[model samples]
Target: MKHIFIVSLALLSLCAVAQQKPNNEVSLDALTTETQFSSDSPDLVEFIWWIPNEFWEASFSQDPSISASEAQEIVSLVEDYTIVIALKGKIGVFGGINYEDVDHIQKEFTVTYNGTDLRLIGEKELNADTRNFISMMKPMISNMLGPMGENMNFFIYDNKKSPINVFEEGYIQFTLGDYETGTELPLGSLLQEKQCSVTKKLHNGKWSYCPYHGVPLTNK
Candidate 1:
């Protein structure tokens, strides 16, 4: 009886510990949908994607059967920050986005974290080998991006030179020349919100209620 009681107590303790652990089961839609923002007006329609490390983490965490080495490869992929800009449709169409609009935005595009302008990763910024490595990973990243990846232009930022602890500051801002949608995005706040039960995705921080379900959105 004493031995059985001890075993039961041990099992109960393990269960308690497991319940306390924060098991964030890697929600891809939540991560991507949360960081993504778009400016859709009668005149302009464009998507600005701030791809954080958490996005990559969630991406790699999808496959449970990946080996240890594969896991390390995933870790290496998220070392730098990446931004994907996409502009759809032809230029100079009435009441639609134009190529020139997006082109100007990219020319003047800038991203800041905790008030520091992140260095843009390019051939001039990174060594030949590192640049080549980034080039090689483009296909894999493109695949991960799905249909939208076709016309997407990637902008890599140097995180190693000036390491960004996004959670520490929890503030990231974007500026795209005269674009109304470009503004400061509070990432820390989004991280705290609950995912919509129906859509399994978090609404853009503006909505108190899920747009699809019409139900109140809570915080975790």
Candidate 2:
């Protein structure tokens, strides 16, 4: 735990440095392959191909005291890779297929005084009293600052929508995901445990296949 926090804070300091976004894209092929593979039912890798804080430090930086709009601007820039820090000082790497649409992200995980947590996936209403309570709570929440770990979360989006939201129809939640950062644990572990299955479609009696496990479309 000590080593982890030490590494994390050092990363926070580095990523908080301001710099021009790198022109060159970070290469997935170049990620270090030092992870131990699992020795269980499925051959999933034991370690995550995690984003190193070096990449975030290289991309851009912001002090924890920076404005919300400033932080939003820094995160909105899609480098080949990037890491974003929230106003309250939590950091998460945001990029994937939904690279361009950054609107669905609400950096502050807000809750009403009535206890209605609005960082939720669906439509949640807050009456006037609840709204007022939230306004009152914001400052108190702001002062108790502790940085969440860097590069801990991700967002996936639909390419079809002009701007995508996970709340829309057909969004699949990672079953173990129960936190604002989404999964209580890193998603790589759950994926490695999944039984690779091909989706079969019988459209008008014609059979076609879709695979969910990174399996090949064609199986001989």
Candidate 3:
């Protein structure tokens, strides 16, 4: 717990050093709704979600203490991977999540993009540059999450071979352990409005796929 707070404070200090923005330009709640997507499964006792670069960009962009250049530099460092964090606890229960469970889930995670299932790699498996990059940003993620960040472990999917344009894809799928019907994050729809590629049908930005044609929606 002491280590967590220390790391979080370090991140806050870094943010303070950046250029300031106007007051209350954007709220964390608003950003969470757009960036974080949760699963609807009632059987699982844990709360897990995927955080894309879009969230970090918007977070830094709207933060009063962070500069645009600093934000871009930080985001660009990990632009080639997929990030997901998980904690063992019920949603809306602000208490600490199990620390032991973090290690367990870190080893058992999967990410699916464009119907291709990919295994998630733990932090130790990452290259030195990427590892260093995550070390700086992980604390910021924990700081922003507050209690939810307690005992949380991050899992990464190396998509460099087949990069994922999260803003262009319909949705990204995440699963931990044997939990089927994993969380599907409608990242593209949340980041920007999309339209059907074939029919040019306009969706209300609620879904990433066309209802009729059953295909991924394209950015509008």
Best by lDDT: 3
Clashing pairs in 1: none
Error of 1 at 153 (Å): 0.7
C-alpha positional error of residue 119 in candidate 1 after TM-score superposition, expressed in Å: 1.3
As a whole number from 0 to 100, the lDDT of residue 200 in candidate 2 is 37
The global Cα lDDT (0 to 1) of model 2 is 0.27
RMSD of 2: 22.1
Candidate 3 local lDDT, 22-111, one digit each (tens): 323434464465545445645345556566666677677777788888878888877877777776544344642334466576666667
Tell me the lDDT of candidate 3.
Answer: 0.61
Tens-place lDDT per residue, model 2, 1-220, is: 9999999778645432222223133222222221111122121111112222333232333345655565445444322221122221222344221111123234322322112222333213433443453344345333422222222223221122232221122221111112222211121211111222355321110111223344322211
User: If the candidates were sorted by their lDDT against the true structure, best first, what order would they fall in?
Assistant: 3, 1, 2
Give one digit per residue, the lDDT tens place, for model 1 in 1-220: 9999999777644322211112145456655666676665455545677776655555555667866577557557557655445444432555433354445556777777767888776657655555675576668766866755555666777787666653443466666655434334344332444456677785443334676887655443
Which portions of model 1 miss their true places by more than 4 Å? 1-24, 82-105, 124-148, 180-220
TM-scores of the candidates are 0.60, 0.18, 0.60
Residue 72 error, candidate 1, Å = 2.2
In model 2, which runs have C-alpha deviations exceeding 4 angstroms? Answer: 1-41, 46-63, 79-162, 172-220
Decide which is better by lDDT, 1 or 2: 1
Looking at model 2, the pairs that clash are none
Model 2 residue 186 CA deviation (Å) reads 19
